[model samples]
Structure formats: C-alpha cells, structure tokens
Target chain A: SQTIHQWPATLVQPVGSPLSLECTVEGTSNPNLYWYRQAAGRGLQLLFYSIGIDQISSEVPQNLSASRPQDRQFILSSKKLLLSDSGFYLCAWSVQSYTEAFFGQGTRLTVV
Target chain B: TQLLEQSPQFLSIQEGENLTVYCNSSSVFSSLQWYRQEPGEGPVLLVTVVTGGEVKKLKRLTFQFGDARKDSSLHITAAQPGDTGLYLCAGKNGSSNTGKLIFGQGTTLQVKP
Candidate 1:
C-alpha cells in the first residue's frame, strides 16, 4: 500500500523565522502533490500544487512556496514566517488528473 | 471567496438521532466528495458522487449529489459517538477544473451518549 510521510509532527516557531516542511511518498512516482493550510476550526485552503518536477502552481498569494525537488518528494518553505502562517499543513498526493489524493500525517505549526 | 457553503457550522445531538448536512454551490461540479476528519488528523474520504442525482450509502451515512451537479448532502441515520468529527464536502467543476477542489467550510458534528 502507498503511504505518505511528513516531518516534524508539531513545531513551535518564532515569528520571522524560516520554515521548511517536507513530504515524501514511498510507493508512488510522478504523483501530483498539493499543499494545504488549515486553521483551527476552519476549512482547508489550497496553497500550492505541483504536477511534476519543478512545476508548481500557487492558488493563494501567501508567504509560503512549494517545490518538487524529487519525483517523490515535495517541500513547503518560507523565507520568513508570519504569525498568520501558523496553521496545520497538509501534504497530499494523487495518481491521475481526477482521482483520490492520499494525505500525509500533517504538520501543526504554531508561531509564537 | 468560498465557492461551496455548508450549513449548520456546528451540530450536537444524542446518539440514535438523525441529521443531515448540506453543501451548496453556485457552480456546477463534475464530481463531489464527502470526507470525515478527526481532530489532529487529515480528512478521510467517505464517498464520492459522480453522476448527477446519484446517491450512495455507506453504513449509516447516505450521500446524495444534486441533479444539476451544483450541490450534495450527507444524511446520517441513528448516529453514534464514533460519528463525532468534522465533515467536509469538496468538488471539482467540469472540464475547466482539473483535480483541484473547492472545499466547503466544514460542519463540526458532535454526537453524545
């Protein structure tokens, strides 16, 4: 079965600090990857998605950026974190154009 | 702007009670999906409705797609405590939209003993 992994299950960061969240899939190659931010008691907002290596699309203009450094690896990064950037970050992967996307464990970042 | 609007942002009921949550959209969708998410976890797919006017049931949960493909509903019969979670409805509009999803503000459900 395919599984997705994300690092730093939880983090407490200071405002203006750098942020990097990593997501990797062990069983799939060339999968469509997505990054989403979910605030407490709120809905998931699409931040970015990548169809292939180095192909990234931004849905909402935010401090966050995403990259597909490897076929099975996706990274979400920020040069400087804002308190507004604090939220639950989720990474998902799908196989085809229109299919089910499996989600990783998710990273909860709380900016103080 | 939120493309999909979910009704009853919060709901609390006793076990064995029945309830329905709605997801409405102005734009037409090719497919609509329902998901259940527990606290501190990612949403899990419950069901997907593709055909217009289609209805699919999973145990106590019944999912319905609008005939015009603009909305969907989830009905739960004889709910249980295990059903307590956040329910989210998402969809992809026709060919113009790929796999990208427009999600509804989730409805948080609490079922007590």
Candidate 2:
C-alpha cells in the first residue's frame, strides 16, 4: 500500500517568515505529485504539480514555489509569507495523471 | 482555462431524505471524479467516471457521468449524518498529460439527524 506523509500538521508563523512544507510518498516510484490549498471549507486550488524530478508546473502566480528533489519527495516553499498565504495545504500522489489520487493529512498554516 | 461549476454551494438536509449534487463544465473532460472530505481532513476519492453516460453505485451513493463527458451528478439516498461533509468534483482534461487537474468550487453538505 502506498502512503503519503506530509508535515507540520499545524503551523503558526509571523508575516515575512519563510515557509517549508514537505511531502513524501512510500511504496510508489515516479508517481505524480501535487500541492493544493483550500480556503475555509471551500474547494482546493492547485498550487503545483510535478511529473518527475526537476519538472514542476505551477498553476497560479503566487508567493509559493515547489520542488521535487527525489522521485517521491516533494517540497513546497516560500521565501516570504503573506497574510493571504494562510490556508490549508494538501499533498497528493497518483499513479497516472487521470487516476485516483491518494492524499496526505493536510497542514493548517496560520500567518499572523 | 477549463473550469467546473458545482451547484448549490451549500446544502442542509434532514436524515432519510434524498439529495443530488451536480457538477457542470463547458469544457470536455477525459475523466471526472467525486470525492468526500470530512472536517480537518483531506478529500477522499469516492468514485471515478471515465466513460460518458456511465453510472456507478457505491452503497447509497450513485454517480453518473454525462454523455458529453462535460458533466456529472451524485445522488445520495437516505441521507445520514455520516454523509455530512464536503463534496468536490474534479475533472481531468483530455489534452493535458501533466495531470493538471481542475476542481469545482465544491459543495458543503450537512445532514442533520
């Protein structure tokens, strides 16, 4: 069985601080990884997705960026955080671009 | 840009009642999926519809994909409090292989016991 591990279940940081969220997948190789953000209880906004190492596609222009250092390790980072950057971040992995994806426990980041 | 529009952003219903959630899009999709998310958790995939006009049932939940592959619907029979959660519709564009999935705004469903 494949499992995704995402960290810092909850985070509180002051404005202008840096952000680093990590996600890793086990039991799968060369899987498609994605990062998403959700505001309040609404839908998820695609942040970034990677097909392979060093191949990242960003959906929106924002303060955040993503990198896939290894086949199963993906990281989301920001040089400086904004108040609008506060939200629930999720990480997911799928076998194919059109297949069902498995998600990790999301991180709730509060920028004050 | 491809986008999906989900109807009834929020729904509150009584137990034992039936409800249907709809997701529509003008752009064609190769596949559509439905997911359920509880509070403080990530969305879980409930079902995936690949063929147009395809219907799949999981217990009390029935999902249907439009013949054009641009729309889908989810119907829940005998709603239970356990069914209270957020429902999301996601579409996979036929042309994109980057796996750039597009999501609907999502519908929040609350079933009161």
Candidate 3:
C-alpha cells in the first residue's frame, strides 16, 4: 500500500518568517503529487502539482512555491510567510491521470 | 479553468434523516470524485464516478453522475452521526491529462446524534 507522510503536523510561525513543508510518498514511484490549501470552512485550492522530478505546474500564484527534488519527495516553501498563509496544507498522490487521489494527514500552519 | 459548484454550503440534520447534495458544472469532466473530510485531517475519497449517467453505491451513500458528465449528486439514506463532515466534489479537467482537478466550494454536513 502507498502512504504519504507530511512533516510538522502543526506549525506556528511569526510573520515574515520562512516556511518549509515536506511531503514524501512511499511504496510508489513516479506518482503525481499535489499541494493544496484549505481555509477554515472552505474548499481546498490547488497550489502546485508535479508530474515528474523538477517539473511543477502551479495553479495559483501567491507567496508559496513547490519543488519536486526527487521522484517521491515534494517540498512546499515560502521565503517569507504572510498572515494570509495560515491554512491547512495537504499533500496528495495519484497513480495516474483521472484517478482517485490519496492524501496525507495534512499540516495546520498558522502565521501569526 | 473548469468550475464545479456545490449546493447547500451548510446542512444540519438529525440521524436517520435523508439528505441530498448536488454538484453542478457547465463544463464536462472526464471523471468526477467525491471526498469526505474530517476536522484536522485530509479529505478521503468516498467514491469516484467516471462514466456518464453512472451510479455507484457505497453503504448508505448513493452517487450519480449526470448523463452529460457535467454534474453529479450524492444521496444519503438514513444518515448517521459518523457521516458528518465536509463533502467536496472534484472533477478532472477535460483539457488536461496531468491529473489536474478543480474542486467545488464544498458542502459541510452535520448529522446530529
């Protein structure tokens, strides 16, 4: 079975600080990875998706960026955090296009 | 960009009651998925409907995809407290094969015990 692991299940950071969230998938190779953010009581918004290593497509433009350093490792980073960056960040993986996506436990980020 | 719209942003019902939530879109989708999300956790896939006019049942949940592949609905029979969560509908963009998904605003369902 494939599993996705996300670090720092919960994070609290001061404004203007740097943010780094990591997601790694085990038991799957060359899987499609995605980054999504969900606001309080709101639906998720896709931030970035990668098809392969070093290839990322961003859905929305904001203070965050994504990188696929390895086939199973994906990272979301921000040079400087903003108050609006506070939300629940989720990492998901899928075997192929138009398939069901499996998600990680997620990380709750609060930028104070 | 493809857009999915879900109705009844918030629903509160008692256990054993029946309720239905609708997801509609103007653009056709190659596939559609429904997810249930609990508080503090990621959304989990409940069901996926691929074919037009497809109907899938999972326990007490019945999901239907429109014949035109542009809409879908979820019907719960005799809902239980465990069914309370945020329901999200996502569609695979027809123009993209990279697995890009467009999500609806979501419907928050609360089944009181």
lDDT tens digits, residue span B1-113, model 2: 98999988999999999999999999999999999998888999999999999999999999999999999999999999999999999999898876667899999999999
Per-model DockQ against the true two-chain complex: 0.61, 0.74, 0.78
Instruction: Report the CA-based lDDT of candidate 1 relative to the real structure.
Output: 0.89
Q: Per-model TM-score of chain A alone?
A: 0.96, 0.98, 0.97
Off by over 4 Å in 3: none
Error of 1 at A90 (Å): 0.7
Q: Write the per-residue lDDT of candidate 2 for residues A1-112, one digit (tens) a residue.
A: 8899999899999999999999999998899999999998798999999999999998899999999999999999999999999999999998865568778899999999
Q: Could you give candidate 1's per-residue lDDT for residues B28-105 as a string of tens digits?
A: 888888988888888888998999999999999999999999999999999999999999998876773337777899
Candidate 1 C-alpha lDDT tens digits along A1-112: 7889998899999999999999998877778888988877667898998888998999989898898989889999999999998889999887857756678878999999
How should the candidates be ordered by DockQ, best one leading?
3, 2, 1
Candidate 3 achieves a global lDDT of 0.94
Model 1 misplaced stretches (Cα beyond 4 Å)? none
Docking category for candidate 2?
A: medium
Which candidate leads the pack in DockQ?
A: 3
Cα lDDT tens digits for candidate 3, B26-103: 999989999999999999999999999999999999999999999999999999999999999999977787887888
lDDT of the structure predicted as candidate 2 = 0.94
